[model samples]
Target: MAFLVDITSHLNHLNAQLQGRDQTVSDLFAHMNAFQRKLVLFKEGFSFSHPNLAHFPACEEMRRDVPECNKTFHKYRADIETLQEQFKNRFQDFYAMQPQIALFTDPLSATVSEQPPELQLELCELQSDPFFQAKGNERGILFWRLLPESRFPLLRDFALSMASMFGSTYICESNFSTMKHIKSKERNRLTDETLFHLMQIGCTNIDIDIQSIVHLQERPQVSH
Candidate 1:
């Protein structure tokens, strides 16, 4: 997997970074073990949660003994077991908190009026809702329609912020590329304010009317 390759490639650097922070090699190894465990758990969670990914063969390829995967099972077996145990404990914790979660979603429905909301419940409810159920399948915004912004302002804002979050640097990189074109070597003296507006106009999808602006003023004559 790419994650496995990335962690392995940076293992020395990661160890060095940990050492600089006054952490020992043993601690670093433990963290690395935890990281691997978390990675597997994350993959399993994705496969289990996402309907489209449920049937994805690649999601379960790590468990296979294929040449391309070439995963070292013995190296990770102990850590994997530990991670699974932690996952089970976490699941149990959530199961124990279901009553509190239900109280949070519909506070009036709670047996005890003073019960607090559960973070896990809110998130679980968000994902389980029919509107949001299909979102991760191919990316949809039906959840927006179902959200009661005025009624649940905190939940609404949280969902909207998460929805707007960029999962990768593609947009940032594209903007930088656009800036290089807009503020070229020939126009290197452009101010930050000028560059910003120029990039905004160049990068955005909004329409601009050059003719309308031209018609607002007389054209200047060039001297021969």
Candidate 2:
């Protein structure tokens, strides 16, 4: 139970880190990579002979009460190994795009010669430009958006494509929750068109102009 608690705590921490809005692919990948490294540390810590429970506080507490706790270390190590494999398999596509991601995230430092022939000249020019070099510290999306379309069209387009990608299913899941609430048993009779309009209002962040809308409505004539 202690092992389960410790493992689940780590998993929950990772899941929390991966959530939220406006997260770019590179940002999410960075979190995943960090977790993968931590998994390696976890596997190492679970060695049978000399267990290192520094990260597993719950297990560490259990060890204080049960002297033979180290005997179960191998089982925990096996579970960690299995999890590590699963992560590797699940994010293989991300691993394959590492080079492109690096280029998109840090174009100034990317190897110009190694890039596609069409982009090589633009990359060299971009890297040499003092203006862009100064703005290199900005977020990847902003940095790419700032690039002159006439000068770095290909590179900017590539960066924009990468930036536009959804890092996780958070947005979709949130929208689904909103839809479910909107189409609940109480409002089950809502037509598709009505539901669509309601969803638009519910999901959008744009503020509706209530006063302007009220004024737009025709008022009835008053008799003296």
Candidate 3:
């Protein structure tokens, strides 16, 4: 799972680095690159190859778009789309182990009978998946809300509070990444306490900024 997290971050980094323009979508045949090529050759060894398992759908569409792409490399590049689709389905199955979060229906979102459906069905599928019933905890893209179906109200409340406060473990990883980027290994070594302080400061600043923005967005200024 940590490997998946790093792969996601690195893929985003690679995408930004490879495409200098604001509106370009070029998939990194990253493993095919000289540096990572050797590592990517064997999918089972390292995590850098994980991105190859998650190529975008748009990349496949490009095959029909570009009539001239007849080379072997072009065909291999198209594998990205297949890999991405596979990743989504595989990931869903893996996350399905979370315990059920039974909640009363709000009926706010559109019903299946409605003209335009909303995420109500998706939520239904989410809660129904065996993933939640099997495991007590589940993680998704951003937050990991505690499922409310369990009998322990205190446990549910604590989990909800932590999920709301932390949102995702991504923020924690971001702090760790920042710590790494801040100082080179060759430089003077810092004590664990110092690094701890840095992460504490970073989290504090982020919390304040997020709260301020949320508060500002909640209130609209009226013209006098």
Candidate 4:
């Protein structure tokens, strides 16, 4: 149970990182890379029971079987590698345009020695600046919000693209969960318009004005 909880928490953390508004493709890759490493280790050693398996005939046979434990392990490793490659290929254009974006994504990187000369000069200034140096617990591109666009033009565009990309369907999933509760059998007769308004109001952070909500009688009539 404890192991399951820990694994769930780690996955939830990864999901949270991916679903951020400021998350970049690079950020997604980095998180996935680290997570994949952990998964590889888990695949290699994790077991249903016991820390290490003693040499048993069944365990030995299972290891040899193509459709059993060995096959599952190989499949997982292959899948991770394939997915990583696919992401790299898909975003190759962005990377080709701005190789320096990778350096800008890392808050801890102190130098841009590998970056092109033009990007190097701008980043070197930011590298030592106290503001960029102060990113402690900040996630995604929120810290980059302070940097001027002129200084990091390539990074600005890259960050904007990342922010625009949808990392997950968590919002949609949450909407479905909300609908499941609201549209129970007893409330099956609720109109689609009413449900839309209910869902919109429930999901938003801003307060809705009572007076702003038009009554059914006051609503604009729609003639077919």
- Candidate lDDT scores, in order, read 0.49, 0.86, 0.39, 0.59
What TM-score would candidate 1 get against the native? Answer: 0.36
Deviation of model 4 at 19, angstroms: 6.3
lDDT of 2 by residue, 1-224 (tens): 99899999999999998898778899999999999999999999887586899999998898898879767776788899999999999999899888788888899898777677888888889899999889978868878878889988898878878988998999889988999999999878888998898788788889997567666768822210
Tens digit per residue, CA lDDT, model 1, 34-79? 5555557544544322222222345345445454433333343354
Off by over 4 Å in 4: 1-27, 46-104, 108-111, 116-118, 135-137, 169-224
Candidate 3 residue lDDT tens string, 40-71: 44232222322233333342344356634323
Highest TM-score, which number? 2
Which regions in candidate 2 have their CA more than 4 angstroms from the true location? Answer: 180-201, 204-210, 213-224
TM-score of each: 0.36, 0.82, 0.29, 0.45
State in Å the error of residue 149, model 2. Answer: 2.3
- Each model's backbone clash number: 0, 0, 6, 0
> Per-residue alpha-carbon lDDT of model 4 for 1-224, expressed as tens digits?
33334445666877777773335566666776676666555545434333222323343345556334543433333544554566567656655644444554674473567765655666667667777677644555676677689877865665576566554676577778888888889888889998888788777778877454544446644420
- What's the ranking of the predictions by TM-score, best on top? 2, 4, 1, 3
Arrange candidates, best lDDT first.
2, 4, 1, 3
